[model samples]
Target chain A: MIAMPDQPSRKPLVELRNLSKHFGEGQARVDALRDVTLTICSREVVGLLGPSGSGKSTLLNAIGCILEPDQGWMRLDGEVVYENRWLRGNLRRLRLEKIGFIFQTHNLLPFLNCTDNVAVVLHLAGWKKSAAIARAHELLADLPVDHRKVAMPGQLSGGEAQRVAIARALANRPRIILADEPTAALDSVRAGIVMDLLHKLAVEQDAAIIAVTHDEKILGRLDRIYRMVDGALSS
Target chain B: MNLAFRDIRHKLGRFVLTSLGLSMLLGVVVTMAGIYRGQTADALALLQATRADVWIVEAGSHGPFAEASRIPGDTREIVARMDGVSEAGSLTLQTVQLVQGDRRLRLQIIGYEPGRPGGPATLIAGREITSNRYEIIVDRQTGLLPGEALKLGRRTFTVVGLTSGIVTLSGDSVVYLTLADAQQVQFDLAPPAARREQARGAARGSTDLVNAVVARVSANIPASLIAAEISRWKHLSALTAAEQETLLTRTVIERASRQIGLFMTVLTLVSAVIIALIVYTLTLDKTRDIATLKMIGAPDRTIIGLIVQQALLMGVSGFIIGTAFVYAFRGVFPRRIEMLPADIAGLFVVVVLVCLAASALGVRVAVKVDPARALAG
Candidate 1:
C-alpha cells in the first residue's frame, strides 16, 4: 500500500514500480522495457521524453492497460492492478472508467460527427445517451474545436480534429490520461496550442497526465519531465 | 452501438449500393430455389389430380414423366380385382402439336375415365365431358375454352371444360380426353396411312396399351403393400404414390434440379466472397480510425463488434430487398417461381450463416490492428 503524501493526504493517481517488458525469446529476443519506476500524483503533467525505440510507447501501453508487462507492479489510484499477474476481472471497464488516451492522429471515427465521436467513450462507459451527449457538448464547448462539433473528422482541419480528440479523451472524466505523440502531426504553433490545452486539462481536471513526446518546444510546459533511453528512464 | 449505426449512416451511399448488389444476387438465388420447388409442384400436380393411392406401370419403366411406360388397358381390371383395391383406372399421356390459327402449340393429351380415379376434380369454366366421343377438357394454359373446336388427328373435338394449372411435367399445357378419343389421337393413323395399311392387308392392331394404371386403395390398407403385390405379376411395375413422386422428382427433373443446385452453391460462394471483399475494403478504409480507437482504450471486442454489426446489417438489408424483388417480379418469369414460407425461412438461415462467415475476415483484420500505428510518424 502506498502511503498518502502528508500534504492534504493526496494519493498518487498512477504508480509504476519495477515494470519490465521483453519482446520474443531466444536469440531473436528484444528487451523493449527495462526495470523502470515512476509515480504521477494527482493533477500532475508528466512529460516522457524519448528518441526512437526508447520504449516510451511500451511504457505507455503498459500504463494504459493495453499491453501487460511481463514483470511489474502497477497501481492506479492506489489499487494494485498488476503485481506479477494482470488483474483478471474487468480490465476493459477499468480502462473505460479510469484511463483516457490521445494519439498523434485525431483518430475520430470518420462516420461520426465530432460530438458523437467524443460521446462514444461516455456511451461505452454506460452513460445514458442524453447525458453522454450533454457531457460531450460541454467538453467540446471547452475545446477550441467546438465550432466544428457537427462536422465529421473528414471535414475538419488537422488541428481541429486533434482538439476534438483531446475533448474525447476528457469525455469520461478519467483519473489518468495518456497521450502518445499527441502533437506530432501538427505544426509548431498548433503543437504548442495542443500542449497548452493538455496542461490546462491536467490542472483543471486534477487528473494525472503522462504525455510521451520528443518535441522540444512542448517539454517546458510539463510540471515534471523524464527522459527514456535504452528502455530505462532518467530525470 | 451508436458508433456502428453512425458509421453506417455516414457511408449511406456506399452501403446502399452494396446492399442493392447483394439484394440482386440474393433475388436470383431465391428465384432459382422457387423454380426448383415450382417444377416439383407441377410434376406432382398430375399425380395429385389422379387422387390415386398406387400407380402401376410397365416393368422396368418409370411412370408418367420420367420414362415411357405401357401396360395393357385390361391391367386396370386386374388391379381392381386385388383385395385392397377400391377402384382402378388407366391413364394415357401423349404429347402432340396442335394448330390454332397460325400458331402451333404443343399439348400434352391426358386420357382419363370421366367419373373414375383419373379425372380433374374441378372445372374452372364450362362443364365436364358428358360425351366421351368428341368432348375435351383443357387446362387454361392451352388457350382452349368451351365451344371451341380442337383438331385431334382427323377428328374435331369440342372443348367442354377448362381447368386451371394442369401443366404437365414438361411444362406443356394438358388437355383431358376420354380413353377412346385419346387412343385415337395417340395411335390411330391418318386416313391415308390406314388406307395404305389396308391395301397391304395388314391385320388391325389393338390400341389398348396405356401409360399407367392408377388405383385407389381401401382405407387402412397399406398402399405400398398393394404396390408390392402388383409388382410380383412381372409384366408391370407398381409404385406407391410417395415412391412415384420421388421418382418423378429425382429422375424426371434431376438434371435441371442438379443444375439449379450447382448454381445456388456457386452463387452462395460468390455472395460470401463479395461480402468479405466489401467488408475488408471498408475495414481498410477505417484502419487508422480503428487504431485511434484502440489507442483510446476501445477494447478489441468493441472494434470487432462494429465490423460484424455492419456486415450483418448489410446482409439483412440485401436479403430483404432481394425477397421483395423476387415477389415483385414473379409474374414476369416465363417459368413458374413458387415461393414458400419454409423455403424463405431456410434461405434466411443460410443467409445469416453466410453473413457471419463473411464477417470473420473483417473481424480478424480489425482485431489485428496495431494501436501503435496511431502514434507512428
Candidate 2:
C-alpha cells in the first residue's frame, strides 16, 4: 500500500500494490500504468484527476475487473482477487458481486425504459423480476429524476440519463463503484448536483466511490483526491 | 424480460415489414414444393380413377402416359377371354384443345365403355354418358355444366355429366366419352387433311385404334402373371398397374420433378444467406448495447440467446405467413398445390435449421465484442 502521510485509518474497501500494465511489444510498447498503489476505505468518495491519456481510464478499468494488470496484488473488501494473476476463475461473477461501473456517457439500453435500465443489473444478479423492479423503483425514488422513471433513455436529458445510470450502478449494491467522467457531459451546476449525489450515495450505500475525471471544479465534493502523471499516482 | 422481445417491440413496425418481405420469398419456395407434390398427386390421381389391374399396350412400348402405345380396339375382346381376366375395356386417349364460347380449353379426352373399369368412377352432377356418340362427361374444372354443348371440331357433344378431381398427368381436366366417340375424335381427320392425304395416296390411320386395353384380374390371381402371359404374344405387351405408375413417376416426369427440386434448393440457400445478412446487420447496430450488457456481467449465453431468439422469431413468422399465402392462393392456381402434413412439418424443421445457421454470424460478432469498449465511450 502507498504511504498515507497524515491520513486517518479506516476499514479498507479496496487495496492495490505494485500494479503495472503495458500495451504492445518491443519499441512499440507503451506503459499505461506503473506500480500503482492505493487504498480506499468504505463509504469514501475519491477523485482520480489526470490529464488526457495519463492512464486514469486504464486504472479505473483495472479496478473495475475489466482489465488485467501484468503484475499486481489487488484486494476488494479484504479479499485478495489478484496476485500477479487472477485468483477468481469466474471474473464476471466477481465483478457482478463486488464491482459497479458508471460509464462516461450514460450507456443505458435504448430499448428499455429507465426503470428497466436500473432493474436489469439486479435481475442479472439473481433477484426475482418483480423484486428487482421494486428495488429499482426505490433507488430511483431517491434520485431527482424519480418522476421520469417510466421514461425512455431518448426522452431524458443528459443530467437525467446520468442519474438513471447512477441508479443502475447502485442497483446491484456493489461495495466498489467505479465512475469514469460521471459528470463530464453536464453543466457546472448539474455537475455539482451529480457530484453531491454521488457523495451522498457513497455514504448511504456504504460503498467506496473512485471517480476518474478531468473536471477539477467538482473535486471539492470528494473526501480524498489522487493525481496521476505518467501512469503513476501521487496523493 | 426477454431482451430480444424488447428490441422487437421497440422497432415493431420495421420488424413486421421485414418479416412480410421475407414471407413472400418463403412463399415462393413453399409453393414450388407444393407444385411438385401436386404433380406427383396428379400422376397418381389418373391411375386411382381408372382402377385397372393390367394394361395390354403395343409390343415394345412403355405406353401410354410415358410413351406412345396403340393396340387394336378388338384386343379388349381377346383379353377378356384370358383365364384370370374378369373384365376388359379399350380406352382411346387423346389431348384436344376445344373452344367453348370465348375460352380455349385444353382437355384430356378419355373414351371408355359405359360399364367398363376405364370409365369415370364417380359423377358429381347430372347423369353418366349413355350414348356412345356425341355425349361427354367433363370435369368441373372445365367450367362446362351438364346440358352445355361442347363443340369439338365439326362435332357438338352434349355434356351429359360432370366429374370432379379427375385430372390428367399434366393437371388438365378430363372429358370422358364413349369408346366410339373418342376413337372418332382421335382417328378421324378433318375434311381438308383427309382430301390432302387422299391426293398423296396416304391412307388414314384406323379409327379402331385404342391407346391400350385395360383389364381387371381376379383378386387371388396376381395381375403380374396375366401380364407375363400377354408378353409371350408377338404383337402385345402387358403392364400391371403398379409398373405403369412407376414408369409415370420415375421416367415420364422425373426431370420436371428434379427441376423443381433444384429450384427449391437454390431458394432455400438464398433464403439462408439473406437471413444471415439481415441478422448480421441487426447485430452490428447493437454493438455498443451488447458491450454494455457484457460489461454489466451478463453471461455470454445471454447475449447468444438474444441474437438467436430474434432470428428464430423472424424465421417462424416468415414460415407462417408463407404457408398462409400458399393456402390463400391455392384455389386460384391453375395446377394443384398439394402439401401433406409431413411435407409441411419437414419444411418447418428445415426453416428452423436455416434460421439457426443464419444466426451463427451474429452470434460470433456478439460473443467477440469487447466489453471494455463500453467504458471507452
Candidate 3:
C-alpha cells in the first residue's frame, strides 16, 4: 500500500497499514504479527489487550520503530516514516525525537536520581542540562512522588518509582508513548493512579498512548481497546 | 550527567578498591623498573668516576666487576712508557664482609694510587687519603664520618674522606685505600695458613698483584690505539673506557636486568588482564541499564564513553598510586631505587594504551546489547 497524505485534522497521530512480522522461515516459521493495522489519534489512550504468546508487543514494537515490520505503510504525525522500509535515515534519532517508552518494571537507571532519570532523556535529545533538569522537575511536580524527586531508584516505593518512570516517558514531550504493561507490578490502587496519570498526560499534552497489557481491570480506563490472538488483531 | 562517574559514584567503594588492587600490581612493576635503573647506575658509578681513558688487566679476563682480572702491579709502569699515554695508576678491587658493631657489612674495597687516573675525582667530606697505609675514603652509605675509625683485615683504618652515591653493581658501598694497603688486606693469610704453606715448602705468592692498570691518553689521541698496544703485551689485556663501560653494564648485570624486565612484562600483562576482566564484569552487571540506555536512543558514543572512561580512570589512578608508592618507600628498599619523571610519563602512556585495549572486551559486549530486550518482560 502506498502512503498518502492525510488532511490535517483527520490525520492520525500514528498510522499503520498491513504490518506483518515473522520470526523464522520454513517449517519453523512463527508469525509474530499478521497483516495487522492500527491508528492512534492525538489525545487518545488506546490499549492492546492479549494473553501470553499473543502479538500485542510485536505491534507495539513496530509502531515504536524498534523492529521494522516485514511489510507496512506507516506514518507518524503526518510524516510517512516507513514504507515497507524505514524512510528515516537514523532510527535512533527518530526514536529519541518521536517516541517514549515505559516498561513493566519501571526501568529507571539505578544510578540516576528521580529527576536525572527524567532529565537524561531530554539531555540526550540535545537539551541543556539546566533546562533539561528544570523540565524534569516540571514533569515530576504533578506526580504523587514529586517530593521524592531527588531519591535514587532503589529508594523509591513501587508507586513512586512508576511515577518517576512516567515522568521520564513524558520528558521529551514525545508525540507517542508506548507503555508495555505499565502497571503490571503495581497494586490495584496504584495501578488506578498510574492509569489516571497516563490519561491526564495524554489529553494535556495531546499525545497518543498505546498500552499493551492483559490487565482487564484497567480496560475501563482506556478510550478503545484492540485484542490480539495468536498474531492476529480484532477490534 | 557523566554516566561513568555516576555509576562509579553509586559503587564508589567497590570501584576504589578495584583501583587500589590495580595500583598494588602496578607498584610492583614500577618498583622493579626503579631497581633495574638504580642497579644500572650503581654498576657504572665508580667506572664513570675513575676518569681513566684505558684499562689494562689480566689476559682474557672481564674484570674488575664481571670476572676476576689481575695483572702485575709493575704493568702500569710499562703502559706509562707507551706513546700517547699521559698518566697511569695501579688499581686493586676486592669485596670483603666485615663485622661492624653487631652486623656484617659487605663492602667493595677499591685501592688506587693517589693523584692518578684511577682515584675518585672529588670528595664530599674532609680530605682524600692523606696517609697511605691506614686511611680510607668511604662512600656515605657506610655511615662513617670524617676521622671515624673502622677496622678491616686486622687493621683499624681511619676514614679521612667521604664520597656520596658510590656503590658496586650489587649495591655494595665502595671504599678507597692506597694500592699497597688494599693488596695487603686482600692477600694476607692467617697465621695457621702461613704455617701450612711453610710446612708444605711452598713459597708465598706475590702480593703485588693489581686488579687493573688504569691510564689516561693525551687529548686528540685515541685511547683504543693505546689499549691495542698494551694488549699486545704477554699476559696483559687492555680495554678503552668505552669498552670497560660496556663490559660493566652488559656483562656484569645482564642476567638480573633481563629477569627484572621479564617480571615487569608479566606484571604489566597481569594488570591488563585484571582490568579487562573487571571492565567486562562491570559491563555485565549493568546489562539491563545498558539496554534501557540504547532503547531510549542514547548515541553509541555515550555507551562507548561510559566503558572507556571507567577503564581510563582505573589505569590512570593505578599509575599515579603505583608511582607514589614506589617513591614513598624508595629509601626503605635494600637495593637502591630511582624514579625519573620522563620514565614515569612513558609508563603512564603504556598504561593508557593497555587500558584502552583492555576496555575493548567491555565495549564489544555493550555495543552488542539488544535494545529490544528493554521491552521484554
Residue-wise C-alpha lDDT for candidate 1, range B1-377, written one tens digit per residue: 45667888998998999999999999989999999988888888878888889999999887767778988889989999999999998899888887787878888888988877888877899998889699999888777779999988888999999998778776778899999899888865435787688679999767888898999999999999999999998988999999988888778889989999999999999999999999999998888878777766678778988888898899889998999999998877867788999999999889889988999999898888887676665
Of the true contacts between chains A and B, what fraction does model 3 have? 0.56
The ten-residue window of minimal lDDT in model 2 chain B covers B186-195
Tell me the docking grade of candidate 2: medium
Q: Please compute DockQ, using alpha carbons, for every candidate against the native two-chain complex.
A: 0.41, 0.68, 0.64
| Alpha-carbon shift of residue A129 in model 2 (angstroms) | 1.8
| TM-score, every prediction | 0.82, 0.94, 0.90
Per-residue lDDT, model 1, residue B315, is 88
lDDT of 3 at A210: 92
lDDT of 2 at B85: 96
True contacts kept of each: 0.52, 0.60, 0.56
Candidate 3 lDDT score at position B368: 94
Given candidate 3, what's the lDDT at residue B309?
A: 99
lDDT of 3 by residue, B1-377 (tens): 89999999999999989999999999888898899989988988988889889988899986577778978888889888888999999999988888788767889999989888788778998898768699999998988898788898778899999898899988899999999888888865335787688689999778888989889999999998988887787688888889989987787789989999899999999999999999999999988899899888898899999999999998899889988988999988888987877778878998999999999999999999988888877
Better of 1 and 3 by DockQ: 3
- Once superposed on the true structure, which residue ranges of model 2 sit more than 4 Å away at CA? A1-9, B189-195, B200-205
